[model samples]
Target: MKGLLKSLLVLALLITSMSVAAERVHLGFTVHYTLKSSAFSAKLDRVVVTKVNQNSPAMRAGLFPGDVIELLNGSVVAGASARKLDAEMGAIRAGDTVKMTVLRSGKKVAISMVAGET
Candidate 1:
């Protein structure tokens, strides 16, 4: 009985650890954007941010709803889709710093944040 209890405790601890580790893989944020064609330039596209997740890295970095994300890690995200953004974010690991160039109320802003778990 003593050995069985010990084994069960170990298994439980392992399961909890695995769960925490799995949860830590995500960056803990959500974003919404609309693609728009530039009026001045026919071929230019824009990604306008509509929301920023609460308590997320985005929020921590001073990103808010209505902020337009222009670049990710210095790379342009003008025409990037949600899937593309996800791919970019997916490539980043926890504790990595994410640099962003954003447009807020017609003013350009730069921000950085350390990625963290959801």
Candidate 2:
């Protein structure tokens, strides 16, 4: 009975560990900051899409290079720092829905994508 209990415990632990393992998300896009500089402080002007990988989630979602990011997950991107944006991206997990509003050719466009496995 003790041996059986130990085996069950081990199985439970293994299952728990597997379930606890989170899958990182891959957006398959790259972005660069557009900064407005001054004598005192450099402020974030915009976040622009630098590249979109072929067949990636970003590409599939209609994101294009030169598109200026306006919103992320329904939040304004204008005042957000680069570190904060990176942290927010890092927090995204696979299967999470991501939404963005971008400026393309002076028009605002919405893009939606599901986070995919890294």
Q: Best candidate per lDDT, number?
A: 2
Error of 1 at 54 (Å): 2.8
How far is 26's C-alpha from truth in model 2 (Å)?
A: 0.5
Q: After superposition, how far is residue 80 of candidate 1 from its true place, in Å?
A: 4.2
Please report how far candidate 1 places residue 3 from its true position, in Å: 54
**lDDT tens digits, residue span 1-118, model 2:** 4553453344323211212246645777776666565675445578777778788778899999999989889878787654455556656677878899999999999999887775
Q: Using TM-score, give the best candidate's number.
A: 2
Q: Show where candidate 2 strays beyond 4 Å.
A: 1-22, 37-42
Write the residue-wise lDDT of candidate 1 on 9-113 in tens digits: 443232112134345444334444334435532221555554566777767789776667798888787765444554565566667798989898789999898
RMSD of each: 14.8, 14.9
Full-model lDDT, candidate 1: 0.58
What are the Cα lDDT values of the candidates?
0.58, 0.69
